[model samples]
Target: MYILYIFRFFIQKEEGMSCCSFLDLTEADLNLMELNMDRTEFVVQEDGSLISECNDDPNASQRIRVRSDIQERRNTQSMTGTNKVPLHMFSRFGTVRATLLHRVAEGQALVLAANGSFTENNRRALMRILISELIKVHGSCYPPDEAKVALAQAIVTEFPLLRNTRTKKGYEHYYDEETRRGFIEYRLWNVRRTLSPSQKKYKTKALDSGKTTPVSPNINLLSQEELDSKIAWMKCTNPSDSNKQNIATHLQETLQNRRDWIIKKSPNISQILHEYPRLLDYNGEMINNEFRYFFKEKSVNFLARFPSYYCPRILEYAKLNRLDVYNRLKNITDVNLRALFILADLLRINNAMLAQQGDKGKGKMKGKKRQRSSEEAEMIEKEKIDVPSTFLVRFAGTPLPQSIQEASATGSIIIPPYIVCTQEENGRNSYFVQGDGWLIKPRNNNPVTAFDLLFKVYFALKICYPAGLQIFYNFIESYVYDLGTKARGVVTSLHVNLSNLKLDKIASEEFIFGS
Candidate 1:
């Protein structure tokens, strides 16, 4: 009867649906139903008899072996065990990419599900698993170039199809050494594929059609410039009349504000570049006209690719957060530095909130405030923390230019870390400092939402700060992602202390942006 039921189970099983299909284990190896006999450890011997082992009882350790067929039992009962599973097979690693890989390895699936689309979650999971695997094979301290090569090799090994798919106009465009490194870096740094308004609309329409086509063959083929051309072509031929004038106005105002801020912040671009020489490839001898020229050259016709809806949304976030400096000063030209500043400010804000929260308990019985007992007062004092004057603000979200990372590491780049005062456990205050490391990309073409960047910076700072010390965070306002339809607030942390602090083993490997 058990064998009959097992055959029925296989008949009912969906093709390419099971995650465990990747493993080479057969029905004989995994007899799930047979585990009902006992909850303790048991070993199967050459004669297929189960031998129980119990440290508590010497007699139980050598108990008579049961001659029951374990494979037959699997059909009737579920297997239960206390041993921890490998991290790769763990529930936490059960992401879309992992699932797809598992399915493919089982030889039941060849591509992503027809109805599935490439998503940020899939990108993040791929980056995470690949990074961890690479770190395991190569040391965590592998150089950036070497790491990319290792990652590419791993990719081809895990997904053999990726190797054969490499062609000039094929889906896999990273077969070349230079392009492969860039592609790997893009994934490692969490850079996303940027789409124009029309492209996004088309994608949404496709998804709404109730049929998810297989992953697009040309999904990652287009660059930002090519997308910009598409947007321009669409605008000239089929301009969107839905809030078109408003979007254009918003874009103009935003660009003007950024330009004004650049002038205000640094009247002479050369002087500012001189102060931060690492930001520039050449010496600061370039004139303002030359700087502007270079900026124009790099920007070209790429600005049109931005989703018109994104402009108004980002603007609203800027106003709500009172980020005049960021909104006014930042543009495609200095996006990298802008991202760094944004991250730094997020850390600073979190610190201030933490400090403020800590101050609440220190009031001296003024008005309706009650005086705390000696014990409570001592506890409060213990919670009060001194903010660090300066500390390292490491970039572990996305890889930056090698020169910039080197400068940040050597203390040549002066990013003053912020501080806050609060008493909170690591788990409680973790959100303010937890990010998946997909914050900013090298180009402004694929700008991240303020909501997204805030968390990235929070995680980056979380990587730098110690958890034993109390931390705090606050979000006065939130940024809307879907044109005000959905909003997300910034997550800030409590404090920073660059003292004689020692990071726990876990903390040391938490952030790996440019490592």
Candidate 2:
């Protein structure tokens, strides 16, 4: 029998995700289900810890009858959330963290800390994690900055007495060896940032209702500035005492575990949102657009490639350690999921590089494969297009304001239509999917740059893909139409006569002037 397990993770924001996680286990996976409720078979203590011993009456702290019928139904239902996640996605890091985050946000986080691995960073990280989960469940406001700050304020206001701030002199103030005793003015960072009407309303609703959701601010702990200070101090002073190291190490582990747990447990956390719904709807559009600019042009040094439609989606999978992918690939299993958290921890180990290297078209450098069954790929591909017109995007007409920065590159891209041009036979067998789709390489392996994809598209599936899947059709159609615009930009015929090497580099870097 196939065992169905529903799970979650901790996604990080800035990347706009949470860091907690969970899992669903099918009845077949649970061996204890058949055991009839024999109270004498169990034991529990005052602290509610079940003692493992068979006595005349095994002490049970709390015994509530679990309906086997309800448990069976819970096992079979489809797990629902935003982000259109396929069930097969799995990440070692994602699974654990998602489970934790989901539990904590719902006020059911388990006590998994082992003797002092809980650092202040870990604690704040866990707290923030709960808040992110709330963001997902409640649907956070648009213009996240104002909404986020407003949320922070609501949280701050909840515990007026717990607020604390940094000194006016700053952290370096305490750096002086001799004058460490002077009274330093402390500056409190009151969570008074911008707030959208809806976010303010949500925070107010939660605060006034006397019910705290996950995203609600933590007024009880040190502020972000203070936490950073603590982290910084922890980093700066290498306590000679071995016990202090052990203590710091413990706190660090606890916090890391906490972060991982939350990230993996949450079902709704969307990671690396470069493009979805509206074209560049969130602030992440700029980096994504930059990638478009970087890859659209042909370059000699770079491999021939075009953008795949799933760039943002793939990025989410990568950073989020998509459980669907992990679960599907039995070969990889959950080993790599743990790898990411270990990776996060590994980063703390000094000069550790988590980047997996590969040879071109041979390894991950060749690329990673999508783990979904062909059926799933078809379903995802069938996803409705919510994007605006690409040609009409008119980057010149609108420039992103300076402050916003996106997370890592989604690395996947949406290739425009392949222009059907008759060419000499470079053929063996047809390499195109469906015998007539965009020729861009799949995201399963080493990422194909948009430049590399364009060439592949030129040779294969030479036709415009219709709307919804028009990313392919758009590229070739737009370029042919804009040929004159390219010609106009070329100042001199001699400049155009440059070698293929130089032309390719220039083209890849610039949007205009390329084959």
User: Which candidate ranks first by TM-score, i.e. highest?
Assistant: 1
- lDDT, candidate 2, 141-176, per-residue tens: 221333233333332233222122222222212121
Candidates in order, TM-scores: namely 0.21, 0.18
lDDT of 2: 0.26
Q: List the RMSD of every prediction in angstroms.
A: 24.7, 29.5
Number of the predicted model whose lDDT against the real structure is largest: 1
Residue 273, candidate 2: alpha-carbon lDDT: 17
Q: Among all windows of ten consecutive residues in candidate 2, which has the lowest summed lDDT? A: 182-191
TM-score of 2: 0.18
Give the per-residue lDDT of model 1 (tens digit) for 1-515: 12211111221223442322312245454475443323434444455433334446656544433223344233213211233223233112233245345434421232341122222233335545555433333322222454455445544455433332213332222223545433345443332234344433223221121221222344333455653454344334322455444434333323332233333342232333233222221111111123233244332221232123223322233333436646753652323223333433433433333333333433322211122223322322354422211221222343333543454456443222221112246522111111222112222112222223332232212212221122212221111111111111112100101111122232223222211
Counting clashing residue pairs in each candidate, in order, gives: 14, 122
